[model samples]
Target: MIDIPDSDRQLIDQAIFLPMLLTVLQRDLAAIDKGSFKLKQPYQISIEAIIRDVQKDLAAAKRYLHKNNIKIIRGRSENNFTFYMVMYKGGEEKRSYFNDKIRNNVEDLLDYYLVGRQEER
Candidate 1:
């Protein structure tokens, strides 16, 4: 097993999950814009705010990865698992995740960024 520093692992995770979260939020924003909600403005505003925050975090993660000579590439998915290839420094590691687990994780991140973080402010 390749030992990866916790901080690098976290940045890598953000690199993977943040984009997914942003994509989901963008889709939700589009739905809110088109849906016949009586008060769509609030929902749209909330989602837009979250989107901006996620984009900032994503950009930071990308910058860190580049600066540290790290690369993450999505690999083929099989059955219930999705694979990722992480290359850092001179070492490479392959990681696999269950598809449903990925969805659940991204959902958790979305909730944190959208509601939990906002509550802290």
Candidate 2:
């Protein structure tokens, strides 16, 4: 097992999950655009704001990964677990995460971007 530093691990996690979060937000925005709603503007504006915030973070994560020569790849899934391969600093490590854990983490991130962080400002 290759040991990963906490900072790199955080960046790797962001690199893996931020794009997925963006995809979900984009799809949600598209659905809102297509659906008939009396007040779509508010929802659209909120989602757009969240998308911009996520994009900025994602860009930073990508830059960190590139500058540090780190790469992460999604591997095959088996049952309730999905595999990920991380290539960092001339070493490789395989990590497996439960599907539900990933979903929950993403949900938490969405909540933070949508509401939690907003309250801090």
Top-TM-score candidate index:
1
Per-residue lDDT value at 46 in model 1 = 86
Off by over 4 Å in 1: none
Candidate 2 TM-score, true structure as reference: 0.93
Per-residue lDDT of model 1, residues 34-95, tens digit only: 99999999998889999999999999999999999999999999999999999988899999
**lDDT tens digits, residue span 19-81, model 2:** 889999999999999999999999999999999999999999999999999998899999999
Poorest 10 consecutive residues of model 2 by lDDT?
11-20
Worst 10 residues of 1 by lDDT: 111-120
Pairs clashing in candidate 1?
none
Residue-level error in angstroms, candidate 1, position 107: 0.6
How far off is model 2, as Cα RMSD? Answer: 1.1
lDDT for 54 in candidate 2 is: 94
In angstroms, the error of model 2 at 105 is 0.8
Segments of candidate 2 deviating more than 4 angstroms: none
